[model samples]
Target: MQLPESQVAVLEAASADEATSIDALAEATDLPPETVTGAAFELEEEGLVEVSERVDETIELTDEGHEYATDGLPEVALYEAALEAGADEEPVSMGQVIGQSGLEGDAVDIALSNYARKGYGSIDSGEITADPDAEPTADAEANALEALADGAVGTDDDLEEVIDQLERRGLLEVVETTTRDVALTDEGVTELMGGIETTETVGAVTPDLLTSGEWETVEFADYNVEADAEDVESGTVHVLRQMSERVKDVLVGMGFQEMDGPHVDADFWINDCLFMPQDHPARTHWDRFAMEEPSHIDELPDQLVADVERVHREGLGEDSEGYHSPWDEEFARALALRGHTTSLSTRYLSGEEIGEIEPPARFFSVEKAYRNDTLDATHLLEFYQIEGWVMAEDLSVRDLMGTFEEFYAQFGIEDIQFKPHYNPYTEPSFELFGTHPTTGELIEIGNSGIFREEMLEPLGVDCDVMAWGLALERLAMLTTGAEDIRDLHGTLADLEFLRNAEVTY
Candidate 1:
């Protein structure tokens, strides 16, 4: 029987009675393990050999684990210190025990979090108590960490739970390697006994081979789809971008024109036209991102700027009085990253961006907005906002609420509740809320209200206009059951979830 040289070599090295690992076959045949694996798989398909696979897991201590192995676990150290401080008999100062234990920074939190879980002690109201019966020397997690640090696999039955704990605690990393083993069948023996000859097999065709008529007679090796290869993460649209596009489609379907503007724009358009006070807390460095270089805008519509300033400083009519606070043109012209995409709505309404949008006109934007915010599960420093507005003859609070009901219903979100809220731009504004599927907690998703005269009048918009700024990530959370907004995008995003989360809505 004629076979490839690699197949012949692998069969010669494999035993009929004992299964030999691919690594062992590589050593015996003096060929690469991948080459041997491919040949072995081919032989298995031919019924000449049998192939089996098993996963071998190896555990090794992380740097932190190694430190803990040498100096003892933080929880163990805390317990020992507590016993020294007489916490075994009575409660002792947690600071005193922690100070004596020498656990600082995150290690203190780690120790306290685990101390109670291991039945080591109780920590309450700044005091700690250690159980006298607790055995620090026999701590299973500590033992597991030490064993792994000492180059032991910790395969003992009793160490399984402790090993898992150590892994969860980030004390160790477990690597699972898939190992293939090969053994010869009866047919393989007969073929070997019959003596094997080497055949030149073409794995791939070259131009010369294709051009030659001899190619028709040449033998070709079968391709193995199961062969191990490098993982390549091909480019695809992000979940957030897909959501943004879907939002654009939804708004367009709802008879809204798309709006585009600069990510960094003048506060005159972002805030001033929205009637958000120049001295508002959100305009401060605490919430807004301000630009430093070339600090103020070079040019703005003189008439529009004067109208906004007049409305902000003086009474717009006999019944309505504007904010008495100092309003500055330079302040309004100062450039900053837009905190909301509603700045586009402001510009569009003012006829500065697009010429005088007519009544019954609807416009929307799905774009990134920047703000200075602390990172958390639900919030990001930058996010995609679904900004939209409707300018019609007679708009009311009911119209705004109905629009939200219709909008959220398309995403399979029902039972949306509205709570009366306040905004500088909208009167009778309400915050939008939806129940989280996983946590069962009510989460605020967006805010909407009819655009006030204080906002629209300065922009030359005569018709009643209702507007809203919705969170795209929050909508995704409602539809996809994502508990964290970070899971959608950012440094801490879950790659697994992003790759697998279906964009249904």
Candidate 2:
């Protein structure tokens, strides 16, 4: 029978025979409606009271509706003037009728249009005629406006229909609010009959209460042990960002250092450094986002550009003939949003960033990339890329497969299927695929290959280097059971999914 003061006040104010709204209880107890609602919920949980909700829509008048109710509708005023000008007996000049109506500007037009539509009068050849049978006092819209102003619109369908019409005319607004009701249970009635007592307990120890020595005498409210709390979304990290951080932690634990670079960069680091040919179809406007303003990068290493151009125009050494199509420094210098974070790998491996690295080096980057992709369940205009590279001596495809196996195993994805693929930069590349748990369909997640000499020789990396570009969103989708990449991000993101999403194996 013991409870907080708020719960006791709510129980006393609530009725056993009928339900009382939370607002009514708050008013009786001199407490906030939100406080009363919370106390009511707690009391309901204890089986001493019941809390229920119903949605109620309230119709109210706007300023224009109030004005029309007091000053009379413009059409009504015009019709009254038309009668006074003797238009009901015969035709009167429209100018003289309008002058008698005392309506001006937009109101004059409103009166003329509605006057004819409501069968009140007619205007023909600069002459107006009013109907003798027309009664302006019986105007439905005007009566509805007055009813709303007086707060007396009952369940009459004709009045409600007029209310709808008035709403469409922008003269009022309808508000839908959730109204909660509280009612006493059998236990609450029995407690009341058994002489319920009010406890002078304090919810908090305020400064004034403490200074007044009232804190020592008053009982402080105890905290509720139940799992009840307000849902806080702003404090929760986005599921995509949570996965990004987790990926970084996993990569760092696997002995990889993080890399940093620009979201917008020169095509040199994005493609030319990857040995992607200038004439490649992907480099065209069909795939990449080309920058317009400040289109070209201001600077690039002269000798490195020459080495890359040389590797492209002719064969690297004597075994491998380069693209041999064409090499344009202008195309390489053009700037655009990076289509992949592999540009960071290109920058790191070339020692242009963070100085030269010896063999047995590992680096990775989890960052954003832009692509002009056809949007779908898995595609987005901008997405995150988990770019990584490993540099060591005597590397092969087996090493690449083993690394993938170990990495994917951390996410409980034991079945990683790799398909052989062709890439201009990598001699033997493979695409990584995983079976989606929900759809049971194989989805491509990443791509990997050993760095070809045409790509590495220009960067002065003599040893074998394995590199990969993984879709961060795809990996998140697998871990979080998100069916659409759009659901994980963008304006159409499902708020309920985001609120409850937890990344798991």
lDDT values of the candidates? 0.86, 0.87
Candidate 1, residue 301: Cα displacement in angstroms equals 3.3
lDDT of 1 by residue, 3-109 (tens): 99999999999999899999999999999998998899889888999999999888878888899999998889999999999999999988899999998976876
- For candidate 1, the clash count comes to 0
With a 3 Å backbone cut-off (N, CA, C), the pairs that clash in candidate 2 are none
Q: How far out, in Å, is residue 176 in model 2?
A: 11
Task: Supply the global lDDT for candidate 2.
Answer: 0.87
Residue 203 of model 1 has an lDDT of 89
For residues 1-505, what per-residue lDDT tens digits would candidate 2 score against the true structure?
Answer: 6777888889989999999999999999999999998889888888999889999898877787789988989989989999999999999988898899899976775677578878998876568899999988899998878877888887778777877667755578788999999999999899877876666778777899978998888887665778468766576889988888888888998999999999889999999999899988788764798999989999999999999999988858778787769889999999999999989988888899988999999999899999865455788879999998899999999999998898888888898999999988886899999988888888999999999999999998999999999998999888778887878888557667888888653
Q: Each model's TM-score? A: 0.71, 0.62
Task: Give the lowest summed-lDDT range of ten residues in model 1.
Answer: 372-381
